[model samples]
Target chain A: MGNSVSEVQTADDVLLELRNLRTWYPTGGGVLGGGREWVKAVDDVSFTIKRGETLGLVGESGCGKTTLGRSILRLEQPQSGQVIFEGEDVLKMPAGRLKQVRRNMQAIFQDPHGSLDPRMKVRDLIAEGLVVQGEMRRDERDARVAELIDVVGLRREHLDRYSHEFSGGQRQRIGIARALALRPKFVLADEPVSALDLSVQSQVLNLLKDLQSEFGLTYLFIAHDLSVVEYISDRVGVMYLGRIVELASAEALYDDPRMPYTQALLSAIPGNERASGRARIILQGDVPSPINPPSGCPFRTRCWLAQDVCSELVPPLREVKPDHFAACHFADAI
Target chain B: MADGGATGGAMLLEVQDLHTHFHTRAGVVKAVDGISFDVPAGGSLGIVGESGSGKTVTSLSIMRLIEPPGFVASGRILFRGRDMVGLSEREIRGIRGNQICLVFQDPMTALNPVYTVGTQVAEALLAHQDLDRKAVRERVVELFRLVGIPAPERRFDEYPHKLSGGMRQRVTIAMALANEPQLLILDEPTTALDVTIQAQILDLVRELRHRVNTAVLLITHDIGVVTELCEQVVVMYGGRIMERGSVAQVTADPKHPYTQGLLASMPTRAVRGQRLAAIGGAVPNPLRMPAGCPFRPRCGQAMNVCVTDPGLRNPGDGRSVACWLY
Candidate 1:
């Protein structure tokens, strides 16, 4: 796995490919219906996920990582660019074809309490997708739901209970089972374990890892916690204000971060054994508003190594080393 | 100051066998059951637990903020040779926000939405001290500066909606520090902010310790936060203190099985691509706690002796554990 970075993966190995995708929302038009200002939630982001691999997306709040995930799923319509899934462009597909294509892709949300319905029983919640697809019969759906619950470490007796009856960890398990009810090949998990307890978080993470292997799943795992991202991700991408600032193998990114933003983020994580002996790089100020980002680099205002060029010109995500990309003007120098 | 047990320094706040319970329709909820610890003068102590582990309730018990249906059943909360278990409402009010201040987790809810940030902080000062209007404004600005809010003069007039999350948290901290309380209680202060913002807040706390001689009682679920800011720690489970020791001793070599499980389950401590040593079961329900040891239901090292409560036993090295294995 360490040497696979340099090897050219075959075209068929690519499960999902995002190309210059942009998702923006109009801001402050005030009922006139013509707003010049736009909140650039996801701006010209491009990435690819290989088959049976996990790609982690990490950023602070309002960095557009969640928007990027929603855009790929077409839950939020993108203004431009492509989301190629299984050699087909998802953005250009017709509604009928897109509906058919979506059966292979699914999502797991962050909040267990908010994501699951209070009125619905565990059985109905897990079988909601199967019922909507209208292909599987009642008995078959029941069998599939039972199997999924067992796979996710739940008992059959739990089917009659409502979501409120279950604990947070158990509710999250039900959420995972529902996501896997259709047996998706690609899953996008957005902060799945952030709301869970420390012990239960590990349980859910281990469950996700086991399920990924048991069913050859490719995942685009998005989270704000850097340690959790580093633990579960094969490759990692760091986002700052709707742009990918750094992308590399998880090991390489943690070991040798070229971008100052990534360096500060890694150092910001407390109780990191590797960082305990070194001086922490504490970035100043809060994240800038996404509605009107800084002119050149989004992170230049808070960057310790920012120079005149950093504020004068936009930096592109370029290869800093073999298979390591960073969007900093001084990436090579770093 | 007792001058006994783990805390040897000049004691600031010492909690002895605290039992805070809530009377519900179904049954009594033991939110904090028999927990004990101390905070030294100018020292920091972190109380860590999951959602139902009673960490928040303990802080509320200390502040005497437990409302109806919830009450501090039995405990000796000693603050500087004064027992605070049965104080009158008016008497406790004097000490609540004046001598000991609290910083909540969500800054948005902590600050009033209608009031300007400056007015809200000024209200905190006006409630306790008898300062003049201009003097109150000056003190508010100084408090904001102390908490690291940028351009305090300009930000003073802005409402809570205008400031960012980090800045809002700074406002809450400034409000907490307005009277220069002898003891500060921070309940998950950085949990709502982003990582960079959390780092900034922790640094502010560290810097404030040097200027003001205030002891800190930090309540959080994150072990990392505890390790970074605290000298001593108390690990809670089912409202019980499972272990109590210095952060160095506990994180480096945890004594209790529950503590070991928690430390091992942390992602920062785990190696990549391997299965995490996850503690299997969920936290026990507050109302339907286990018969003997609160954690025995999920503990891997539970013995027959665990059927009876081991209570808190002192092992060597100035640490305490409540497990049969000890």
Candidate 2:
């Protein structure tokens, strides 16, 4: 009954595939006013999430990692893209059918404080999705809510209390419970543990892993912390200026990065004394504005390997290794 | 018993038996309860702890920045052997930003959005230094260049929103450096910046440490950053010092159970997929703190005698630990 989004067949094992997704927000003015500029939040980013796979999107803030996750979930409408979910086009689904699409996909926002409604009880907060979808009767929803609360490591008493009563980690558990209440096959977690303490962060991460195995869930995990992403994600994608600069297995990307940007990012992780001997390539300056990005390659401004050709040609995502892809002009050379 | 001051020379900042409390309607909350540490001159000290560990409040106490309901009840905050808690408002104001500057995490909040970056830097210099308007402009431009901000002249007039996160951080650093403070109290200075940008800022701080010879009090929640910047380390929990030692001694061989739990929680360079050893429970509520050890509920090594809280006594290798095991 929960598997309603698989409307068509692409004859592939991947659960979600996004092709050239672009989500831009217009800035400045409108019709009878000055020319408007578009902040290319998610510019032509393309990737796939296999069934039961966790694809970690890593980048600094303003790099559009969150926008990419939101766009894939259709939370933010993309200007143009192919959001093929379970062989069905998520972007092209009708309003009535779109509800079905949403039933199979869920989102866990970053801020636990702002995400949950303070007025609602934990019971209704978790059961809100099930109630909206009308997937079960009132009694069944309540029982399931109790079960979900227990599954998320919270007590039955917490169900009657408001979100403000719980701790940050407990509130995040409530958020997780709410996201998983509908039994969505895929979940988009955007910086879920960033707000948590180090000790609490590991608990949430462990719970997410346990839930993934128990429920057979696939996740599009978005986070800025490389260490946390490495701990959770099977495969990782490095995004910059609204584009995927590098994509590879977590271990491969950390151990053997090819793209200059990727290498710079990996080197920047504050490792221990053994790793301190290696020289860190601190980028010269901050990321350029996405509204009016640097010409040719968006990352060319900060790239150490930048040559004249980097300014004249856009780098395409090319497979440098067997399974690793890097969007750089000198991918083969590196 | 003889905790009157820094005692020995070469220590730049000494916080002795500090007790900061909040007289709220509910009750008195001992935010910084008898914590003591020292930062050597031209050396950096990092205070690492989770939220409400009194790390922030301890730093605030040092700055004499505590306000009405919250006050430093009793403490000796010696800056270059001068008493901070005893200083008058006007006297302390002269010390602040002139000999002791603060660098915070969120740069956007530090820099006034209404004014240009140039104006902010110029204002700090105008307050502290004896520079004329023309000299202040030249010095602001110089400070920006010193902070490695690209095209200092062009970026001088840019508002906080106009610059990216990293550039905004650099501008705040420029303002902090305008007065050449002997000790820089950086409260999670790079926590809000991107990791790459954080690397840049740390490298900049390392270089400036030699150039300006300024001692740094780097307070953060991240151990990796503590290892990267500070030589001395203090671990705080429930507004008390759990462990204090050289970073090499404490981080490499953490003595306190809480310190051990905190270190084990972090995902290291180990291969992916390994489960992290998470601490069992959350930090206890300050209002309803457990009778003995603040971390007893969450501690894996809790014993029967843990009900009696222990004092921070030195174990070997110039390190102090507050645990029964030690």
- Top of the candidates by lDDT: 1
Residue B25, model 2, lDDT? 89
Worst 10 residues of 1 chain B by lDDT: B1-10
RMSD of candidate 2 to true structure, Å: 3.2
Instruction: Report the C-alpha lDDT of model 1 over B144-203, residue by residue, as the tens digit.
Output: 889988899888899999999899999998998888888899999999989988988988
The fraction of reference A/B contacts recovered in model 2 reads 0.75
- Taking chain B only, the TM-score of every model is 0.96, 0.95
- Candidate lDDT scores, in order, read 0.89, 0.88
Q: Name the regions of candidate 2 deviating beyond 4 angstroms.
A: A1-11, A29-34, A272-277, B1-9, B269-271
Q: What DockQ, on C-alphas, does every prediction get?
A: 0.78, 0.70
Q: Which interface RMSD values do the candidates have, in the order shown?
A: 1.2, 1.4
Q: Tens-digit lDDT track for model 1 on A1-334?
A: 1232212233788999888999999888767777568999998898889999999999999999999999999999999988988877788777877777788899999998998999999999999999988899899999999999999999999999999999889999999999999999999999999999999999999999999999999999999999999999999999999999999999899889999999888888877633456468788898888999998989999998889998899899999899899999999998
List TM-scores for all candidates, in order: 0.96, 0.96
TM-score of 2: 0.96
